[model samples]
Target chain A: MRRGPWLWAAALAVYAFLYLPLAIVVVYSFNDSRLNAEWVGFTLHWYDVLIHDEEMLLAAGNSLFIAFVSAFVATLLGTMAGMAIHRYDLKLLNFMALTPVAMPEILLGVSLLLFFIQVLNLTLGMLSIVLAHITFSIGFVAVIVRARLAGMDDSLFEAARDLGASPWETFRYVTFPLILPAVIAGGLMAFTLSIDDFVITFFTAGVGVQTLPLRIYSMIKIAVTPEVNAVSTLLMLLTLSMIVLASRFAPDVLKGKT
Target chain B: MSGPPFVFLLLFFVAPSVIMVLASFRYPGEFGGLAPLFADTQTLHGLTVETYEFFFSDIIYGYVFLKSIFVALATTLICLLLAYPLALLIARSPKKSRDLMVLLVVLPFASNFLVRVYAWMIILGPQAAFSQAVNGVLALFGMEPVHLLFSPFAVLVGMVYVHLPFMVLPLYTNLEKHDPALLDAAQDLGANVWHRFWRVTFPLSLPGIFSGSALVFIPVLGMFAIPDILGGTGDMLIGNLIKEQFLGTRDWPFGSTLSIMLTVTVLLIVWLTTRLAGRGRHYA
Candidate 1:
């Protein structure tokens, strides 16, 4: 095919736009001076500060805690739902499964807030945030697990059943092993999303329960600082590394295959 | 799926959203929160179209709403334009290259979305690397450095940059499934490259385009942080407005009404896009 110069130029421009900011962020994180524009001598002062910053460390820990717990619980429920939907002929189940994905975050956050505040008369805090995270995280896990189940050969399960295996035994010995990769991939995706979430967490979080994104948001509102750049650079690297690892080991799972 | 999952959806997703709709219709309290839905005549009977009227009639609000829609539309258009070629490239690339490209795209999505937007802040702000670079280059031409951050243009740039991957992945998947022999047959039939793309490739990629647009447009409509950080005070979008009503002004009734309005508008647009795409498919 004869390639156009204009096409290549446009693609390169877009790719640059997508990446240049991130590159700048990473570059500036190591600067000795706080001034973002000027190139100062390279130093690890900001990272050292980040290491000792107790509040930021605590917020990061809280975020990790919430993400893992929510992802684990959501994955469990998602696996059950995936098995049930695939093994049976359920009407309107697909639409129900897709509802959380389709609904806007603001809508979900507000409604969940109202339910907790008005009906349940419960104080908003980490539990509310975890509950909110689980609500959407489950949908993600279900989508991936269900896709895996669809690609799976059902005769294996039938054969297990025919060989004097109970339904639970069939699931434990055959079905579980087959869909495990998808479940792990989905769980990692969910954890990343839960950690990254700002809007839903903002609505549901109570006073003094700051996640990392919330902390960053507050800092951004106060001022744009090199510290935030440092934080973002580290986060971007961590997420990119995890995603690369997942893509390497489990390409089909990440692509929504069994 | 059968009983429990359905019940969970009904109780959580369906019921809560329905309550939000109902809450929008309720009267405003004296303190500016939502009054009782079944309040007395003094409150409920006096329910007016005032909020909607205010939103539509005020030039600032109207302009902000229009600009947001325009930004979202421009973002979607840019994403489509960029994604098509990239998707085509990935689809036609060697298998290893395709995997590498897919990994590149998926990496950004897995990261913190706010952090990525924050990354743009560092690059576009007054003291940004680009600002310095541009200032240096422009000094040769004898011009001062131009302001880039805290502007509508910056917001549009951030929106498009962040959402580009969403558009690319779907288009790549759909385009990858197409048989290459069709393109070869078109070439054999004496169709030029441009004609082949317009008549054969473009129409076949409509589903992917629709899916990508849906993915980008809906979330961009409800986005708050991107505009807040990059857009600054004067460049408020609908998301900022909705956030202000809830947090700043303590006007839950008005905020709920605005939420309802935004939700309805998005649903209408999604329906319209799908219908238009369906028509395009049929005609093509």
Candidate 2:
């Protein structure tokens, strides 16, 4: 189609649509006004308020902790699943790992909430949240790792097996080193996904546990405040850097292909 | 290697889904959750398809389900329209700049999505400049000012904003793969740009469009937080209803039933879109 006049305007408008809400957010994070409805001279008062906000700080801590643990477990499982699928062509494992990521977040969240309360009788708190996070995150890690594996030639593993090395040694020496970048990138991707996740975390969180997204949800629901904006800005920065790092580790992961 | 991950998924993912199905068939506990399931009372302990009956008993549930579908479809259409030009521009850019452009489209994580939605809350608040400007215009016509934050318009804006990138990425991926020579051939054949696009570009992009629509539509179908934050009281969707069962009303059975309905609806839509898109491609 044409790229000269109308196309550029359309593109500009789309960009504005995408960025304006965020610009409003970032701009208001520093706004001095309590209402956050308008700009009333720039100040870092909201940041100061966020710094002192105990509940917000606690929620942030919980989010970081959940992201760390869930990402670790999910990466481990996902890397295995990725390798297993690549090496053995396990379709069931393939579906199980990937479907959670693809399915609507609420379905997963609701199902987990039911499972926790009914079957396992697990207490809904940090462990429940971590387990839930891991469930969804494994798919992402498996996708990246499997992608990395698929791009590789089969000869490397064949060469290792041809040597005197055992299966464990072959993996430790060859496969581990080769997919480390993808694995790291996958873990980082999982980290960001876990940290930014809201819908899944919402249902599984029960009544006691509160993550950053949950806190922000409640805050925004109750009333808009610059502190929420401040927290959102900082959380965005945190996840942004994590994404950049992930991409640096494995550029194709950001493009999201196998 | 497969044993561990497979076992983990069976325990967590698959089991939960199965349990949800079971829960949907059972009665809601007198208190909430599983008290009634495990209670010594025989009647409450007995499994029934009552939740399913209750679901179809009233047209209200079906109406909400249908509304959710309409919302999802509208959101998908709007996202496709908004994302197409941007995706095209990115796909058409110089190779070096394409990555940067795509990254920019995906970069709003810098505000995170919750904050992104909250940004709308602020902008559409009654006292905010955007709302005031809108209301000021309405005032010129002697119409009543609307509460923009808790309205359907706010919900749509939030939905379109959050899901735009999903549509953009898929289209960009597809558009990037198109042969420029095809467009050039059409041009040399005296086909206008609009003709070229409508005939060639769009037909080829059906798969991308379906995939993107699935990515957007499926999620929006189950979204609760957006409507919770941005929509009015009457703006309840399937997501909010399911949420209400589990959280608000504490009716786990009904909630699970609603959830099952949502899952089924999502699956149906996915199946339909893929089939339609597949047929479209065959014709193309």
Candidate 3:
């Protein structure tokens, strides 16, 4: 069947719609003028301003710290959860592992906000932010690891067991080697998610703490500035590179198949 | 194996959800402009339905929810319109080109959510070329130049833009599975392109459409950032309202109450869509 010209045109238009705004943002970041209304000349003024902004730097520090810690913990728990869901037919485990993934961010954010201050009496700061990040990140890691598990050959485990290996030895010898790429990919994914997260971090990171997204949010809320644009461009580049690298290094894991 | 994740989730996810439910029922203390936490033993002990009653008593909160529903519905529809052609094209494309097309869709999504929204703020801002050109047209008609930023239109645009990928990915996944044989069979039966698509391909794509709708609709319903950033005076939705109750109003009970209601709404929508999609698929 002939794919018509209109189909191509429509798809192209959609692609443009998806990209044009972002392109404009990137272009205007170096526009050499405060007013993003018109481009006068290209300059690195925004990046200069961003570099000098201490508050923004501090927020970036907090975000990176939170992301690394949460991603590490979430990966450990998620790898286990993923293994359990795939190896055993535990409905409860499946539900627990996946439900939070499906839950809306705002709901999770608000609920955790309440949980921290109201019940746990945990001060909302880096610790609270890390906990919240882990809560959401676990589901992501679990999903990726589970996807990797689903594509594996079950006979490998059976063979290990037949060789008189204990369960731990079987896992250590067989599963760990097979799923390492996915574990790393999932960890990277969890890291990306934790860093990019805005809604959850917004709620959990009380008055004192500020993450990059939170800082960006407050800046945009006041009004758009060149520094905000510069930071956004940099952030977009950061995440894009991470995802590209993750997918590149873990092609099979990214594809959820061997 | 599941013990660690289960315990972590039970503490952070399930416990918070349960607390949110309880907090909705528990009384709030008048605090010094902060979330009225469990103030005293008596207030904490009592499970009063005052917050729920307060929601039911006032119509404004209900109106905000209705408006949110409307915005979410509209955004979903618009996203479907934009996403369908793109998804169909990608699904039909050669295998070599398909990944590139999908990556294009996902690349923009890889950017921070706030950055994505900020892109629109610039596009819709008065001084931007798009907004200026729009106002220029309005000037020709001798009509009042409209403020595009901080308006419902901007909010809607931001919502659709943010969510278009969600709709596309699911639809593409479904559409990619359709057999060429079915379309060929329809063509041989004297059905033209439109009829073949409407009868066979479209019906087959219902499951995809429903899943995409659920994906788009639920997130839009609870989204506060787009509306908060783009909306003018009259564009408050349930998200904005719930956000205010917690952050601005500092009323945790009412905020929790609103969240419970939002959760129920999402659950209801997802359940209904599944049932409806199931029936539609059976017929298809």
Candidate 4:
């Protein structure tokens, strides 16, 4: 069969559609003028301004802290759930565990906000945001870990048990080593989701708590400033590198195989 | 044990859902707000189906709901059309090249979605690069440059752009798993390229198409950012409506009603797609 010219053209066009916008953003971040349309001489003034911005730095710190803590908690809980699903075979539990990803962000955000403010009487801030992140992040981590557990060799666990190893010892000697890559992958996945989250975080992070995405949202809502472009460019670079590294290190996780 | 995650889900996920459901049935207070269930048992005495009634009775809300579905459907269809060929090409490429192509699809998703949307804003903004380029071409034909920014078209563009990768990724995954032997056997049986693809390859790819549709449709249906940023006055999606209820209108009961309705609609769509796809695969 002959490969057609149109196929290559279509693929190229799709790639362009996917990437051209980010290229434009990166290019304009260094544009010397306020108006993104006309490019004057290039300058790194936006980066200089961003480095000096106190509020943005604080927001970035809060986001990093929240992501790290939430990801850790999510990975721990999710690994437990994944093990339970593998051992127990409760189909409904499995379904319920993975359902959060399919739920809309606005719905999750609003419902959590209502629950925290009204029912729990918990003040909305970093704690609320972290809890919300864990709530959703748990679903993703469970999914990755569960996929990893499903493809695991059952004989290895049985052998450890047959050797009279205690449950803890078997897990430590056998299951832990096999699922470590997935655990790390899930942690990375949770970290990325928590960091990039906007809607759920927006609803939960009441007054005075601003993450990087929230901060960018406020700036963009007012004006598409060079500082925002600069910040976003750096954020994009950071996230892309994380994802690439994750994909390389834990290829199975990306495939939904483990 | 499953104790930790199950408890967390019940407390955080299920409990909130129950609250939203109960709140949806109550009446808004005098201030167009909802008192917490514990705050006032008095409001519970006045509990009514008024919020749901408002949703059912109001044509505006119904229109917004339908508009959300319509936009989601359109975006899904467009993404599917654009994604199928790209997925096929990537699936057919060499090993190293295929990985590169797949990375290209995923790289955009890893970036901040809001920033990508903002990129569209610049490109589609008035007097921006895209407009100037188009106008430069149109000047030869003596036609005016069309307004692309802050319009429905711009919103559609942003929606499709943001979601194209989603559609492509699932399709690529499923397509990559297709057996080349099936196509080769069909060819040996004297089936031409068109017939082989239509009879075997296309039918096998339906699962990918369905899943890709589900992935793209659900998010686009409830998406607030894309529409909020690029949309003009007339582009109110269900997400925008829910946001308005909580923040702008302070109508928590009606907001809860809308939220519940949107969730049910999304769940229904997902269920229906899986069912239909399963049936389609069986027939194929």
Could you say which candidate leads in DockQ?
2
Model 1: residue B178 alpha-carbon error in angstroms: 2.1
lDDT score at residue A20, model 1, on the 0-100 scale? 71
lDDT of 1 by residue, A130-189 (tens): 888887777777777777788878898999999999988988899889988878877887
Q: Write the per-residue lDDT of candidate 4 for residues B1-284, one digit (tens) a residue.
A: 79988898888888898988988987665676575344465434446788887888989988999999999999999999899889999888876787777877878887888898888888987869788888788988999877788788888999999889889988988888988888899989999989987998789999989988998999999999888889887888999999988878888899999999999899899889999999989967
Clashing pairs in 1: none
For model 2, residues A1-258, the per-residue Cα lDDT tens digits are 346677778988998887888878888888888887767898998899999999988999999999999999999999999999999999999999988878778999989988887777888999999999999989888989998999999899999999978999999999999999999999998888888889989988888989999988888877777888888788878888998898899997666355
Model 3, residue A251: distance off in Å is 3.4
How high is the lDDT of residue B107 in model 3? 86
For model 2, the superposed segments whose C-alpha errors exceed 4 Å read B35-38, B41-44
- Judging by DockQ, tell me the better candidate of 1 and 3: 3
Q: What is the per-residue lDDT of model 1 for residues B170-264, given as tens digits with 9 covering 90 to 100? A: 88888888888998899999999889899888999998899899888887887777888888688887788888877677676567777887888
User: Could you report the DockQ of all the candidates, in the order they appear?
Assistant: 0.49, 0.73, 0.70, 0.70
Decoy 2 TM-score against native: 0.97
Residue B92 in model 1: shift from native, Å?
1.0
- lDDT, ranked from best to worst: 2, 3, 4, 1
Q: What is the C-alpha lDDT of each candidate?
A: 0.77, 0.88, 0.88, 0.86
Two-chain complex of model 2, DockQ on C-alpha atoms against the true structure: 0.73
Give TM per candidate. Answer: 0.92, 0.97, 0.97, 0.96
What's the lDDT for residue B1 in model 4?
A: 77
Clashing pairs in 2: none
